[model samples]
Every structure is written in C-alpha cells, then in structure tokens.
Target: MGLLDLKAPSQAGTMTEATGQSSALDPGTPQWSVFGQLTSPVTHPWAIVGETILLPLIAVSLGLWLNPDDPLWVHASFPWAWFAPVVLALRYGPLTGIGGAAMLLLVWLALNLVHPAEFPKLFFLGGLILVMVIGEFSSLWLARARRAEAIQRYLDQRLEFLTHQYYLLRLSHDRLEQDLISRPMAMRDALGAMRNHIATEQMDSDSAGASALLRLLAQYCQLEVAALHYLVDERLQTTAIATLGNTSPLQADDPLIEHAMQTGHLCHIAQSLNQSEQSSRYLIAAPLNNLDGECFGLLLVEQMPFFSLQDETLQTINLLLGYYADSLSMHALAAQIRRKEPDCPPEFAFELQRLWHIRQSSQVSSVVVALEIQSRPGMPDVAQQIQRQKRALDENWLIQDVDRSILATLMPLSGQSAAEGYLSRLEMWAHQKSGQTLAELGIFGHILPLDTDPPLALLQRLNEIAHASAQTRPLRPHA
Candidate 1:
C-alpha cells in the first residue's frame, strides 16, 4: 500500500531523476551505468577473482612491454594495478576485497623476489599499501551512506501519502454526518407539519406517510431508486411507495428482504451484469421495527454508481427507517386501541397481539419476560456474570437498560410451552455457565393467548406483571 508500490509504471518514469540521485549516493551500481556485454559467459567466483587478478596483470604487462628499458615502469604501473582490487572489494564486499588484496600482494612479492633491482623500495611499497587500505574503507562508507539515504526518502514519501489520505477521510466523514443527521431532522419537521394538517379525525388517510418516507430517502441518499415494502405472510409486497426511475418491481422472494428480516439489519447488492433484467442494480433494505422490536416492513434503496455505499451509510438508513416505523406504529396502535376500547389509555401490548393475530390460534401463547439479577453481598464478581447472561441469550430477546437489569424477549409466534422452555434454558445457562445463584437473580414472565383480547390490553397486562415481579425482589444497593 505504499505510494511507490501503487504508482503506475508510466508514472514511475517521472521519478527517474530522483532515483538517479539516490543511485549516485548508493554504493552499488550507478543509475546510468550500462553493463558491458560479455563475449563469453563467466562463472561467479572466477569472474570476481579473474577480474581482480587479470586487469592489474594486463596493465603491468602492457606498461613493462611498452617501456622495457625504463627502470621506473614497475613503480608507475603500481597505482593502475590497485584499481582492480578496489573494484573487486566494492562489488563483492570486504571478504572478497581482502582476498583480492592478498592476490595482488603475492604477485608483488613474486615479482620483487624474481627481479629485486627493478622493484620499488620497501618504504614506497608500504606507502602504496596504506593508500589501497584507505581506498577500500572509503568505498564501504559510501555504500552505507547510500543505503541510509534511500531509506529516508522512502519514509518521507510514505508520510506525505498518509497525510493526504487522512484529509480525504476527514472530509468524507464530515459530509456523511451532514447527510445522516440533517436529512432526518428535516424529514421529521416536514412530517410534523403534515401531522398538523391531519390533526382533524376526518383527514386521517389524506396525507401519505409511505410516499413522504420514500421521497426523503431518495433525496438524502441520492439514490436511483427507493421504495418501502410491507411484509405480508413472509412475502415482500409493494406498498403505495416506490421511486424507481425505470426499474421493475422486486421479486416476491428476493434474498435481500429475507436477509434483512433474518438479521434485522440493512442488506445490500452492489452490482449486477444484466441491466434489462430485474434485480440488475445495487439494492439496500432496512427492516422497520415497531416498539416491541418486531419487524413490520422494510425500507429499500438503490443508488447510482457515483455514490459509494459504505457500512455507515447503511446504518444511517436503518436509523431513519426505524424512526419512521415507530411513528407509523404509534398511529396504527392508537387507532386500533380506540376501536377496541374507547375509554382505555394507549396500550402497546394489546395493539401488538391484534396486529400479530395471536388470539385466533391455539398452537401457542405470546409472552414477554423481564429478568433482573442482583449480586449477593461480598460476591466476587457480578458484572462479568451479567455480561455472560447477555451474550448467552438471543440478541433480539435481550434489552439492556442503563441499569444492569435486563429484559428477556419472546415473540408473538411463541406459545406458553415454548416460552417456558426458553426461560428454563436461560436460567440453566446463567447458573451453569455464569455461576449466578437462582435466588440472586429474580426471574418472571407473563403469557397471553393471542386470540383472547385486543393488543393494547395484552400489553397492559404484561407491563403490570413485569412491575409486580420486580417489586417481589429483595431491595439492594446499586453496584
């Protein structure tokens, strides 16, 4: 992920000048140095040893042949002879340098022994050795300096790229926040205005909530298509809400809707190969849950290619859809409650039971259970036990309050037998896995047959039972 690694080969050409400077400082080959084409292939060690020995030998032999009568020929050739050993040490490192230096010394000693009169004096030979040593050390230092410079340049480039990336991320985050926060506020205000217009009982169905929701979603998300669909008998059925530019209706059994209902999350499809076909575009759906945390409908969206649909975007859509779902549920429950019991206060449980059709079936009873755990005095650890219990239960069934007390959930489809089984499993899990004593944790539940009463009455009864059960627990100080 480094900038240099990401750069295209064509773009890399622009960096040639900088690279050449780096190479010049480098101890290795120069940037513009072209390797000589070999007439014959050379082996590695032979190449190193031969190049070191042969170049100097050639220079000395040529010098001697050209100036056969000159006594100073050998001394004049000495400096040129040192060139091969210096190059060998630079290319192959210190050990090879020492080996090449040893070869030159042996040659020097043999020549002196054979023709002592023609050789330079001992003091001069000592001076020449000192010069060769200095040259070898200087080459090593140059190599190290070049490597350090290359590393520094690499770090500098990385820092620059990261700084640019950071600013881009910040701007993107700020824009996303505005879209998520401000759009919802504006929609809520518009809905409030509409509510005022429909305040009179006679104007109930005049304003379209679903249509307004679709419009707000499309405008905020900049979507190519957006719609709201109600789930009818586990099927995705189109409501009076749609904003597709030219797209067809989504299939009844689309996998996207199933995923949303199953996970209670927003699901998305990013691309498709076919344009003329149905479901050929990116799709996102957020499940709409009522106050009881039951999914009632879904908010669907499809967007153009210009926008990048990220996870945060999906979550924002879900939050806005949840708000709309809550509003619609409140209005529907109020209407249903008034029709059932004109004198009663607004009841959530009763409305839910009616909406879920729990009363007409004999197979099961709908139940909601609330459980509270109080740690014993001087208990070793209670917070850990609470966490264990929370994780053990189904995420949909657990409701966390600011206080440590927890609400255990059961759905409309559950019967008395099934609810009891669930509670038993939960109690066993807490005691066995979390080591929570039964007495320390107070457990209670309320069961209502779906067919027996209106939804509001059922909710009231459940609330009353929950309160009564909490009061029975031994009062203790909060942790």
Candidate 2:
C-alpha cells in the first residue's frame, strides 16, 4: 500500500483503540499524579522535585482564581500553598525547597505586578525563609533514618546466613560425637572382651569365630536370636557355624542372605522394608566381611522385641559387625605380613622416608589418612578412583588387609585445608554412585598428623583406623 494510503474509517477506529490499549499496558509509560504533575520511575532524580514546584503553583492559582476580590496579602500568603515547599525541602534537600519557594513567590508577584507599593515582599520572603529552615532540619533527620534502615536490612541478611551455617555445623558436630566419642568406647570394650575370650584358648575354626561373634552381639547388643554362617569348599557351599535362637529359613542360602553377604550392606525384611511394610515378623540380615570385603559370613536375626532399625541402632550393629570383621582380618593380615614380611609398597615407602627426613631437618608436617571403602569392588578400582581424584601432592595407597577390604592413603604433607579437599572430592564421588556401587558402599576415613609422632607411629595409627568402622570413622587428629 502507498505510504499515505489509509485503512477504511472502521479500521481507523480499531487502530486507534489498539494503540491506546498497548500504550496503557506498556511498562515504559509513566502514570500521571496530581500531586507530582508527573510520576517517573525511580531512575529519575528530578521527578519528585517537579511535584514540589507544581503542586504549590497549582494551589496558589486555585486560591487566586476562587477569590478574585480577596486582599492581595491574603492571596499571596495562602496557607495551603506552603505544603509543596515544605514537603520538597524535607525530602528532596534544600535546593529543591528553594526552587519550590521561588515558584510560589513568582505566583504572588505576577498577580500584583501592577501595584508594587501594595506588595508584601518582606512578609512573604521572611515566612518562606523560616519554612525552608524548618524543612532543612526535617530533611537531616529523614536522611539519617533512611541510611539506618538500609544498614539494618544488610545486617539482617548477614545474620540469617550465619544462623544457617551455624545450624549445619552443629548437626555435623553432634554426629561426630555420637560416632567417635560415645559409640566407639562401648564398641572397643565389647570387641576387647570378645578378643580376650577367644584368645584365652585355641579357636581357629569357623565354628569358634561364630560363637565368639554371637557372644559379642549378645553381651553388648542384647540380641537373643542370631546366627553366623560362612561359605566353605572354594565358596561353593553355605554352612551355619553358630546360632543364638531357633534357625529361621534365613539360615539357608536364601538369596536375601546371599545378597547381604555379597554387598556388605545391612538388610531388614518385614517381608523387606520402608513401606512401612514387611510387618512385625521381619528379619535383619547383615553381611560379615574380612578386611578384603569378601563376604565371609551372613549374620541372621529373626526380629526381636527391642530390634527397631533406627539409625542409632543400625549404626551400633554395623560398628559391631565391622569390629568383628576387622578383628579376623587383622589376625590374618598380621600372620601374612609376618610370614612374608612384605615392605610397604616402594612408592609409599619412599614418601614415608622423605617425609621423615623433612620432619627431622625442618618443621615439616605430614599426615596419614586411612579410608576404608565399604563393599568397594576391588583394590584396582579403588586405586584408580583415588588416582583420578587425588590432589597433586597426595600420595594415595591401598593397604589391602589380607582379605582386601580396607584402603588407606598416606599423604606426605596434608594440612587441614588439603585434607578437606580430598574429603570433599570423596564425598562427591560417593554421591555419584547409584545402583550397585551405591548399594551398601560407604567411605570412612581418619587422619593422624606426624607433628607429634614419628612416621612409624603414624603408620601404625593409620593401620588401626583402617580396620575400624568402614563408614563412620572421623578424620580428627590423633595423639
């Protein structure tokens, strides 16, 4: 269509109506305000000042128009006309107040220009100066109040952030106390007593280990029904070595028992769990492994009166099972180490020697972190994972307890910051695993600095923690 061509008349109204609708909805448009003349977005510094000048001018015009015969003095000194100047000065500072006052003065002068002698210049100017002074005082206080409000909002946000951080820290500390301080003491005592009982006489057979484990669980955990079963004949058959209560069908090579044995995770079957199902006649079956995480036995228990699988109770049970597993693994590894006298891996031995020399020559600090991965597949996989995730300075090692379940890393000079870096990486790795890898897998670690102890003592400490709980060992310093 030609540039000047117009739509039909009916179409012209539609276009105009459409334009009006769009203009109304457009966010860029400013609304009119009688008080301000125009209300602009906050980005404009002069919008509010415009209100100050316009409102007073309009008031004076109205007052003059309404009473044409009123005295010139009364018209110029209209009380309502002062409202704009006073408010502008209080909110927009003194320059705006002065502008508003000048605008009002011009209104008076314009109306009585023909009679200068009758004009009340001194009276009007004096009153305006006093009003401006009062506005300045009010403005000073308003500025301070606004600044104070901003600061209060900033502080409130900071306080809220700190409160959230503190709450998370408290939860972490409480978990540590429960795992390290309280439960470990009881666990150590029970395991020690079991060791003494078994060591009192010769008990090398699978039957003897089972009896002792049952005893430990009974005495410490107060379990009335449980059994320990191990595989024999090249892992081809299942054998029940001990029993606390009447043997349930779980004593056989049920797939559930085998599943727990293989994964080293705990299984509780009401007929199985978390429906809130499986009911009251459920069973709790946990796998017992040696240091290498080879499922050596299945620990089966028909549900008992006191046996609710809460976190605390489950943790205690796992700790006991772990301690039991570690004891057997420790004995076997000690025998193997004594018989073969294997030195630390060449790389590990070199790192330890270098650190020891540095400690002697200068103020050097080194630490050993033993991470026991639960139901972790094999040393090669664990080694590969650590190798990929480890820091440049970190010297990772897999101390395969004879059964091959525990993994420990010897860090030459890891301080608190370095240690946390490794841990956060490990935490990330744990979270990535889903189906089988995540089934019962857990990573537990402990750190011992060489600041006080020699390299040898630190190694021994790492070995000690290597066999503790494979899921809850704390990375606190050791003496």
Candidate 3:
C-alpha cells in the first residue's frame, strides 16, 4: 500500500540509505541497496506520523475508486482496506497501527451515514486484533535493536581510545630506540620523575611546575634555548614563566607562534607558512593542550641542534607537552579533594577527577567503594588482602593505622550495580579465605557512586564518614 516492494513484508518502509548505515546495516551489503534502507525502522517522529497518516488514506482512496458501495470491502471475500494498518503494525509497532485502524473506523462511520449499511463489527474487531499482535512483536525487536546500537557505540569509543594509546606507545618506543644510546635517561623514567614532582609540588598558579617542566623538556628534547609561557584569557602572556639555556623574551607576533595558535597544534620552521619567517627568532612553537583540546600554555623553541630537528623529536615534544597539560589539569581538579583529605593518595585523586570528567561528557559512570577493616588477632590485614584483588582498571588507596585501616577502591567506568556485585564477590571471598563472613571479620563496606555530586566532593564526604565512624568507636589499647 505504501508503494515499496511487498517482497520483504517483514521489513519496515521508513528510512533512506543514510539512516541504514548509521543504524548498522550489514557491512557486506551496500547501503543504497533496497533491502538495506527500506528495512530499517524510521525513528524520527515526523516521518513515522506522516507515513502512519498517508498510507491508510491511500488505501481508503483506492477502495473508494474501486467500490463506492463497500469501500472497506467488509462484505467482500477479503477486507483489502485493512492491509495498510496491518503493514504499519508490522513496521512501527502497536501505537501507529492502532492510529491507522481508528482512521478506518471514522471512514466506516461516514460511509454508514451515506449508504445506510450494517455496523460490520467482526471485520473491524478482527483487523484490530491482528494489528495488535504484529505490533507487540515489532516493539520487542525494535527495543533489542536500539540496545545493541548503544553497546556498539560504547565499544567503538573504547577501541578508539586504545588505538590512540597504541600510537603513543609506538612513538615512545621509536624515541627510545633513537635516543637510548646517546641519552642517559629513558622516556618512562623522565615521565615518572615528572609525575612525582607534580604530585609533591603545590600548584598555586597556572605556572606551578613551569621551571621543572621546562628542564624536563630540555633534557629530553635537546633544546639549547627555549621558553614556556602561560596563556591568559586566550592570549599569550609576554613574560616567560620558565626559560631554559639562556632564551630571550618571547615574540608574541612570531609567525610560528601565530600558526600554532590558529591551528591548535605544534608548528615548526619546516612547515609551510604564508608569512616570511626571515626575521623570526623561534624555530618551533607548540601548544600545551589536554585531551579536551584546552590549550593552557605555549612552548617556543628559540634554539636547538640543527641535526636534532626531526619528526621524531617534534612528536616527542608534542606528546610530552600534551601529557603534562592533562596531568596538570587533573592535579588542579584533585587539589580541593586533597586538601579535604590530606592522607589521600594523589594517584587516586587524579583518577577520580578524570573519571568524573568522563562521566559528565559521556554519561558513562564510575564508583568508589570504601572498605573499613579492623585488625583481627590471628588473621592478616584484610585491607591489604583486598588490595591484592584490585581489578586491572581499578585504583586502590589504603590508609592504615596501628589497629585499623580504610581501603578505598576506585572502579573506573563501573556503576552502582557493579559496585554491589564487587562487594558480594568480596564477601564470598572473605568467607572462603577466613572461614567467616565480613561482619565476623570486622570489615564494613560502603558504596559511594559518582553521581550528581562532584567526584572530589564525593570523595571528601567518604573521608568524613570514615572519620566519624573512627571517632565514635572505642579504641583498644595497643599491646
């Protein structure tokens, strides 16, 4: 009735070719193929409503032209006018199918006034039942399809993240291969040192670790002279926050710097430029950016060894700067939580902040589970025992006193249900290993899901609850 082929009656007649590809049609089949496009259900509201209205009207009009006396064909061998509603029911489901049926009822009533025919109750009743049956089945299958699409999208994101990480790994390996013999320090060692410096230092301003960061870059990048400048209100500040190896003041209008600013990526002398760089002093310009594409600072290379200026060296600079920017951002966000809980591990705080960002942007969730363990007479520390069971992606922070310990585990990309399942598993493990339940072993569990509250705030609240419980309980004298 809708002009599409009836050969695939099971398939819906809704979307065009583009929608088919987005909805994940078979990879082997071309999107333009009739089977691919027409089979997919229409998700847009206007399209569904339009088709639901138009198809039944077409059927009714055709019926009127063929037989004015019994346009619905109720008295004929077959009630052909009911075809549109049944097809629609199979396509979109019950609500749309029921709408088509209601239209036919209105038409039937109008015909009764003109020709004075009987009610024909059985005809309409049978069509409604058929439509309802087909629509119910369609609804169930459509829900499954939508759920599958969501899962596919999440997997795609994970794959993309892994691919980027793989490229970073390859780049690091290439750098190591090129510099291992000449350079005394490895990239990983330098990175670890930088992370330790960031963890220990107080980030009072945007240029918190500027000097140390520049020194690290100088060591790795073989820079004879360079300067790092922080951005203020989207404009580069003239004064250099950190300078290495006798660098002059930054030139704000340098061609390389302007190019880097315009493109939001690393720019060097070798790159094509519209402006003449004959007067420019800097050899390379790089923006310190995080994964979110926020540029907080700029690195200008005033001088470097001629032979050292290569693709590998430039990529190393870009990668290190990006990593530093991301780390700095995390430290800034985690600083508040760190102040609230001084004993909290910096790694845990940093990860919590990162996960909070991911949750906000992608709606994927992560949870923090706190397990309080009281030292028992015979058994080993339950907190440390649980720490050994940390999952691959989980980060654990264990705080220990003489007689008590609190183990806070951050399960990345997990939800409330996942936390519950983890707790249940831990409870079973405790029973099996210690021959007693969690209660018997003096271990208490609390699940704090990262939700409406900020992650830093949530972690601070967890510390408060833990401290309150510690203060109220009576302490046993140390032996």
Top TM-score hit: 3
Write candidate 3's Cα lDDT for 19-59 as tens digits.
Answer: 11122364333457687577667789999888888888899
What tens digits encode model 2's per-residue C-alpha lDDT throughout 372-427? 65554543476456557765445666765643344556665456666656666666
Scored against the true structure, residue 336 in model 2 reaches a CA lDDT of 27
Q: Give TM per candidate.
A: 0.31, 0.31, 0.60
Model 3 weakest lDDT span, ten residues long: 1-10
Q: Note the Cα lDDT for every prediction shown.
A: 0.49, 0.55, 0.73
Ranking by lDDT: 3, 2, 1
- Model 1 alpha-carbon drift over 4 Å, by segment: 1-188, 191-207, 238-240, 270-282, 336-479
Lowest lDDT 10-mer window, candidate 2? 15-24
TM-score of 2: 0.31
lDDT by residue (tens digit), candidate 1, 42-66: 4487786777677556655665677
